[model samples]
Target: MTFTFTVLIYMGEMWKGGPDTVGTLHKLTIKAEPGSVVTCRSAVTIWCEGTMNAEICVLHKEESQKTWGTQTPEMPENKAKFSIPSVTQEHGGQYHCYCYSSAGWSERSDTLEIVVTGIYYKKPHLTALPSPVISPGGNITLKCISWVGYDKLILTKEDQKFLSSMNSQYIHSIRQYQAYFFIASMTQDHIGTFQCYGYYNDTPQLWSVPSDHLKIYISGLSKKPSLLTHQGHILDPGKSLTLQCCSDINYDRFLLYKVGEDNLTEHGNQQTKTGFSLSNFTLDSVSSSTGGQYRCYGAYNLSSEWSASSDPLDILIAGQLPFSPSLSMKPNSTVHSGDNVTLLCQSTNKVDTFILSKEGAAQQPQQLKSKFQVWDFQAEFSMSAVTTALSGTYRCYGSWDSSLYLLTQASDPVELTVSGEVTLHDYKTLHSTAPHLENQDHTLENLIRMGMAVMILIVIGILIFEGWWSQRQDKKSTSHRVPEHGK
Candidate 1:
């Protein structure tokens, strides 16, 4: 007679050959090939490894009631490979495996989640709260928003597992669903590109299309690169702009970051005559959107770490407002030293403020609040005790409170000349005649002083000669008288 033994295990309880051998065996390990996150319609293999003498391996989806059992004879490597020829949303879930051996049934393996992406058509939008350039030990929030009302949103850093998930909150102000993931006490490890997805709770492993990549940068990493432009920061509309990012270090690339922007513009480095590695970022037909605070960073091709940010550069856009202002100077454009001069900026259109800019001046443009005058809105800029240092071509621009960085067309250029105790308007005529007349008068005065000096020296020499002659005659007379007295 042929006798057979059967074992049944359920909920950590096992019945081997008999009730005496009812102990749990070693645990099996389960993993996914390539990655746990797979695209829809792609092939993937789930691997379950167990002891060498394992007889049968069973794979079970935690969310479903069905189970897949395979005999160890099919896979000679003491493992079970379950291949999915064409993956679908149904294949996405958490899975575990168990192996049965001669001793007993093995413990259940750790859960491995399989995520199938591109299952939904709508994609989400990812943005950084406050800014993406964060300092170490600072906190940042990543906001994932979508028009489709997903149950939850998942945030994932590149090459990392799902970092966090949050239930979607409907924002009535924006009419969109969004989830905020807060990361506290940021460090260098948190600096990387990230993406987000939307998913429903019923099928946690199925996800929508990923949002666009957003990069998080850590500030104060290394030496900063320099950001500059050949043209001044103030620009007119429709003008082409090119900003240069340069660094003394041999960086392989450069990134231009605009404040309050979600994305960074990157460019490859090139050799330049300034002996620094540099990159040029160009914007064609610049508009008001191009104006903002900008900075740049240097990075290497092999590393994800970026250098410290460059100094902030503010770009101002002109010719945005409909009307321009008129600039005029009181007491004429030419003024003497210690004279108070007033520059009036007048606009017919209602203006909230006025900005006075001097051509080629290193200081920031001067701003003043506008007041309603008899005929128009105007602002007066007063200069007390003006000097030659203030001499330059000046222009004024009108702006509204709504757009601080945008300005009206520049006013007609006005030239201001501070003569500094001299009348600069007639400077050419005075320069041509005054020097020659002053030289002639100086030569005559010098000649008269030299003649008086010679006359005084001649009088002093005559007085000394007369005293010497008188003394010699007295000595001779005394010698003759002394000889007579002795006789």
Candidate 2:
């Protein structure tokens, strides 16, 4: 059966700035990443080299402005980097650097102009060079990719300003824009979420949308800690769970890290015996957000170092339902185009909403409230005049208001087989029975295969159109040009 699906868009929001300084100009140099053009909602890095006794301060100035504003963190070092997470149109401007030492403030360095590009365009793509995880003292790289033409690309770590640089392999292909950042000697401080952005070469202030987030996980420690959950990794709502961290070697403190979260929960001053120490953090009532991967670390008070992280534990909250919901089709037989169909989602527990999802669709599940009240909660989704797209394997989920966006465990899948001609698999013979595939269900698998075929065709069409457009533009430009009298 043929099938088509709509695309689903996730909701979110974004925004832009410049610089001034006074004092003699120093012989310092300031550098900008991705060749000075960037996109909004993308990260950008400005760096300056410094002396041992001098405190480096990054300064920025807007176009046609004399005064410069300072960006931090001003530290005494040999070099400094100032990063902007999500550069907006306002961030387009000229940037320079100055060094402040006991003698006095040094002169401003050569100013680098940053132009914003694709201010109203989509975000670029970001990916790790080799792998997401980095061992201590190892090197790693991140690459930013854009289809639209952009000159500059910026990389940021979490929300903190970080060092940014571009590699020689910038923009390897004309069909897409690309940049790379090589981070050498990774450490625990480098562990955080990262994102990239692109900017137009001419319009330094305007930025493109942000690339997808990339997280850097740091590893390599002396010994690994142990992670223990109060009961099991899975639990129901309103239940308590204690996550404990223990270390075999001597340690005074323990830390628990929730993957994707920025901060680590610390526990200290716990009682210990026989060179073993343990600390636990408890959740009084579990929620949807509480479910995720977690790891523990052991630390010593004497040294500011942490032991290797424990094996990650996957935690899941089953909502407040005692069991999963049930899903079924009304006809319970072979279906075809132009037929009317109803999908029933039933659960024993009361739920605020029921979501019906077709497997392998590029869209979010369709949600509906329980229209009819009954002992066994049931929600009916009616599809009038069904089309070929409506034939697929589907599942239902029960959810409550307290859980907000989280869904309970999924119900068993119901398959809707569609054929152009009717056969023995009609309602009379298959009534009261759920549709099943022979050994394996191809409803979802077929849909996915069809979707991939469509996507490939679209991509091929776009390449052909782009080649034709480029030639057409060249011809038009040649025709409009005026010949020089001398030539």
Candidate 3:
């Protein structure tokens, strides 16, 4: 009755039980970042006279009410075990277990607290300190931000991480201006959203929203201009054409800087388009000076930046205008005052236009590109009907280049003499050149007398014939009477 068996005891969470011994616990605690998961395997050994039920401490959720592990029986008389499922910081709290011993339930063991720690990724934000403008090529600065507590952060653009700031972050927070990110002269090269992140415990920070975009602007003038034809096509001087100045800029200035001239030969911006281009100039008249350089410039939309010239233009002006235009009669022979004649204009200069007028006409000059088909592109002012007054010095004016440059001087005056070839005054058109129809008049009385002499001779022949017939009739009658006597 006094004899008892002794079992060697192991240190650390191993307990020997007796009729008076109380249950004790070895609390295992864990710490990690929030949202981090931890798996804990707990084992307990109890030495008791009879089998007893035991449970690994219930994992109390620091936030939610839930147990981390299940209960187990000490079936091997002194061995018991339990396990904790995936755990989170929300499950962080005091945890303990109890033994269902025959000598009444043993007291709860020491608390097992878990501290979950791990880095978390949080959404980051990006903002521009000053409002930015976006142009083709522009400069920009942005503030990359992460959570306040996440001191260490990494910033990146596109996929390339900002290497220098990976370990440390300059802009700690937005409220306090400490550091900011900037791109030197932004271009198509720097066009993209930037992201950022920081090292955290379980609450891993994320990249902030991309910063506002920056715009670039530029301006340019045509050194060797590209000519833009409106109504027609690329034109040289003398040929009529409209010009336009294009740019990748706001339409606001589209009309303002409409058209301009090149500086090669002409004073800049002095052409018709420059002054009359509906937007500001019109090329009704073009010159060699109008052919060289052109430019279009203006501010960008709501930005300080400007757009460069759309495209350069090159224009060639036609050669000098027709030289002295002179008038002359057609058909080299003498033109009688009554004969119709056409006055031809010959040009010393290149011909683009021809003007026909009487000496005192103030009418507008007539354009003559194809008005009349004379030898080598020309027209004639004709005297449809000839008149002494219509014979005044005949002259003509011709020009080329829509702007009608120097015209040919008037031709020498043709002194015409008037003559009466035959006076059929009633049928004569003194000033007309239409085909002439003539009436021949001979003296009727003289011709009639000559016919009377021939008629008298014919009467004498008729009398002689009548006398011979009378004699033959008398002889026939006498012969008939003699035949009757013989009967």
Candidate 4:
């Protein structure tokens, strides 16, 4: 005579349980181990403790959404461990755990925010504007460049998400593919390790791998950095030179600028910091385009104020090339069609190379090594089967390198006139312009005579054809007379 009682189930805050029931939701604790940052496409486990015999649910808070909802977990049990097999951009958000059992639903656990990063796509390149160092009370810009067309770009400091819209005072769009985040009136708090990520519109949840981390530091400098070049003030063209930016105080970064150019055109790179930071700007090959007055600045890091401009150093490129080559053609006065012409370039001083450039020619200049002669050096440029197109003003120069800016002064230009087969229209015009002068030039006279002879022969051939056609017509008429005898 045993009796059993059944209780009606309701979705409420509390529930009555028997001996078979396990612990309630209030006794459970959910947590993420090893911090919240998670790499994309990796596995992460969320552990829930003390909620035995209960249905567990995970809730995610998205950046764009304010509400939280139920999410499925890989494993759901007491001390449940939920695994995210492949984390993506969408997986980056705040997460919480909830449990429901006979004792009713439990409150959500503390939120864990996760961030996913990867190298699966083209990442945005991060660069600092107006130099990485910012004055203590000045402004600076961080530029995010993505050429592969990304819908969104994000910047992070110390692995924490940074919203450009919220953190930056001004946002500038450099181009369709570039964005700049401007921070004004920077303080020591603004300095940190920074990285950038890019995201496509179709896969907004997925983020590109973090860019190289840029560490910014604060510096107090009253003097500018010293600018020094390896090769004195005068640099030889076609030679490599390095401009070093040095400072007396310890710095993490250095910047170099062409004195008169726009500040936006300044150049800077990550440099090693010893007792003092030393950054070197190398011109692999110097030319006239690279010669200018340069100044440098030093700073602790991106957030540090820049030192005052260093003493300006003038860089001049001087060539040691010999005198310009003298240009002369095989046939100086006239070049005829299908004729091979050789243009000889001679230099009184020994030259290493010769370059022949033609005026108004889109073609590249012809280059040749100079041949040692008894007292000078010479080079020959041959134009085979020359045409009117080859007739132009040509000049030559002697130099060791191929760069135009590094070569010796150009030689005097030589004019060439090519003669080709003259057309009938040209001949008529020539005759009309100068009838008596034709006999003086035998070539023109011969062409005119040939033209007249061809015209006479054509007329004679036409007359003969007309006579033969008339005879043929008469023969046909006579043959078709319907038999003259019967008529």
Candidate 5:
């Protein structure tokens, strides 16, 4: 005997069951094993999970009408596994699955997109709009561009957790096809390396080669690190420069970022004698392109968050302009303390400003507006009551207002010598005289004593002469009187 089973229709599918309402079956879920993104010729599995009493499952591709079915016991009793031995470009697309049981066919699962990479040879170019360094609650835009005219672009993060796609737009100005992905309110989770891929609309899952990696760094997450350079910020072309990034938080890594630059220079942290963590970045034979505002950040190895940015350091490239300035000190380079001094920086060419820099100074160079003098453009920096602290080797540079970071060649260095205070003793000793007033007083006292001795000797001589004359006269009278008495 032969038995016939009546089939009922629901949601455009034939199933063997009693009369039941459509769209009332339990929903099923579908997911890709490993990941939805697969490399060429790699193995992958599509899982469909539902009720344990499910007898059969059907997997359907959204792009095509192809359907795959799995019987019970071949997979687990509760789920169905549709395995692909070697995935190719044709196997990549949107997919859904349905499971059939006593309750009838389950609702179609949500769509899952399977991407196949490394299908094309040309790769897209990815870049950040302003820079990769971002602060918390900030926004950044990532641009993906290509010449191949792909219709779609996909951006993927390093951890495989973030995936986004956008339709490409033709940019006639740049003659390229591009797409912009804007990330808003950046947080610690947004800090990571990223890459992009390009694909056509017809083959959404088939992608070209991946673009070069672009790293995104989030700042203001921890304490900032200090940036320092032993070499002065103003440097001649072809000079070697080394910048140090230091922090006291024991960070494991350091990142050096130049403003208006897309790439960051990274280095491992080294412990210093003061128990501070630091990293040194060196640039050999630097040219004009090396000059810019720079900042540094510190980060730990295990965490993606970076510390706050260090203070900006502006690097000026010298000898890029046409003319240099001359530096001179008024009233001789050597001056006494408390004397007002003036440093004159003069340039033959018309300059918008003058920069005066002292050697080994940690502060920024002093800038002054240039004034048209009798013969040239000059700026005078007058220092009143100059002290020894102000004495140092100074050089001047000329720069235009438009290009403040680019400067002319350095002028000849002028040395300033500030002598100590000059006392009255010092003035007398310099003229080869007695250093003290007491010696002059002693000489005047000796002259007065000699004059008094001379006066005393003359009075004694006059008295002796008077006494001798008186005695002679008296003896003569006595002699005359005695002779008369005898007659």
Candidate 6:
């Protein structure tokens, strides 16, 4: 590239200002990495001194040893700058500016040490502490990997600020220079490149270009997995409530879904979190139509993929078909006094015990004596003494081999009231209250039946007598006629 060398020049006598302070090298270093930019700077006071044809001067630049890797900035007149492109380790050599004038070249300036300082951290890379690429929804630890022995590390990402880190001295002593950078809860922000750097206290140097980029990633929730109820809750229509989906923070995004026979629909809101409780803060309000098993998920947000699922969680509300266990007596609502009554609690679930309880009774609830009855899918509780005190309210609670469903909250409450027995005076006073049976005309009907039987017997007796008289007359007449014929 053709460029003008613009520099300020002054002669000792001919110009107003004369003597220029000598040039001194301030900061000089040699450094470069594969496919990277290398730069050098210096502090050398230059002045013009030469014959008429061509004025002469010398330029100084930062250097570690005796070599020149980059050229200094353009100067106006006497000062001269020398530069070579793509300077490599082979470019190392002693260098200084020489002026070609009638007086010949000037004395050489002080030598600046030039030595390239790099390649210590061979193939710098990053690694997570736990071997697994994916994370579970809990606590975890991580480490930024580097070539053994490489120190002075700077961890950074494309759009994020750099976060400094250090390798353990113990690790270095054990040849484990790879630094461990801990994050309480692994999150999406941890994804990026981590590099190792070395200072240039001895060479033509600056920070070596960062080592090859290393990528950090967080796995999806499903990568770990969990189990949940298929039909979460049988929520009453229009009841105001919310469902929660949770996981660890290792994934980029999260999802909530309702698994169906044919398809899956979003059950609640989808949110993003950067902290440890990956799923603790994620939840959505419950809707009237929300029903079915739902589970949380950690999204990969990858170019060619889907989110991972977590261990499923099942929620079920009261009144669901496999009902939450409803307790009711044989004759619910109302029953005749002194009737043998049987109470039962039934559910489409497995239960270990069924508790029978009654309110408005003579005794305190828990202290009140109760019974636990068991059956295949239910329990039967019986009480023979039917009293007004016994007539308050009754309910049954079921328990699974494990887990408490807040028996009182999950089960329904039943109301019971008993009536007194009937009596003669009471019945006469409130005859209208009684439903009449067909026994009212029994005696009169019996009398009528007797009279009809007696009359029928008398008529049959008279008919037999008449028939005997007629037969006797006929026999006599026939006998008399036979006797006359014989005479």
Among all candidates shown, the one with the greatest TM-score: 1
Tens-digit lDDT string for candidate 5 (1-487): 1111222133234333321332447777788988888888889899888655776677777645435555442445487889998988888888877766777667778888899998987899899977898888899999999988888999999778888999999989989999999999998888888999999887888999899889998876699999998888888888999999999899999999998777899999999899999999998787988888999999999977788899999888889997789999998899876678899999989899898999988877888999998889999988776666667999999899888889998999999988886433334333343355546544545655887888898899889988998999999999989978999
Q: Sorted on TM-score, highest at the top, how do the candidates line up?
A: 1, 5, 4, 2, 6, 3
- Better candidate by lDDT, 5 or 6: 5
User: Which pairs clash (backbone N, Cα, C closer than 3 Å) in model 5?
Assistant: none
- Pitting candidate 2 against candidate 6, the one with the higher lDDT is 2
* Per-residue lDDT over 1-487 for candidate 4, one digit per residue giving the tens place of the 0 to 100 score: 1111111132121223321242234755666654465676787766755554565443435343332333333444466567667766677766655665556655656666676668456766777766555567768787777766666777777745455521111234544466677778878777777777776655544567776766553434567777886565544577888888877667666777764343322344444544655777886687777766677777554444666778877664544464567889896648676577899999888678787777755443677999998888999998766666667888887766444235666788899888877444344444454678464456666877998999999999999999999999999998889688696
| Tens digits of per-residue lDDT for model 3, 1-487 | 1111111121112232321243433223332322222222222221112224432222223333333443444455433444334434343344444444334345545444442222243444555433233345445565555545455454455434232243335443444322366656555545444554444433332222222322222332322222354533223345666555433222333321223311111112322433321123455577555544344444323433333443433333323343455566666325555566766666544566665545432222333463544445566655544545444433455555654433444445554443444333313453132343332222333455677887987898799889989999999999889977987
Per-residue lDDT of candidate 1, residues 1-487 (tens digit): 1111343234224322322333367777898888888889999989899666877677777645556545453456788888888889889888887777767667778899999989998999999988898867889999999999999999998866447889999999989999999999888789888999999998889999899999998765789998988777678988899989998899998999998889889899998787789999997788999878898988898877778889987777999987789999998899886577999999989999899989887555788999998889999999876766678999999888888779999999999998755333233333344575445544555766887898889888899989999999999999889978888
All candidates: TM-score: 0.74, 0.38, 0.21, 0.42, 0.67, 0.26
Q: Scored by Cα lDDT, where does model 2 land?
A: 0.66
Cα lDDT listed for each candidate: 0.82, 0.66, 0.41, 0.64, 0.82, 0.44
Q: What's model 6's overall lDDT?
A: 0.44
Backbone atom clashes (below 3 Å) for every candidate: 0, 32, 67, 3, 0, 37
Worst 10 residues of 4 by lDDT: 1-10
Error of 6 at 96 (Å): 19
Cα lDDT tens digits, model 2, 250-314, are 67888777765544577893667667678888866888778777888776776555677788876
Q: Which stretches of candidate 1 lie over 4 Å from their true place?
A: 1-23, 68-77, 248-252, 271-274, 299-305, 336-340, 360-364, 369-377, 382-392, 418-487
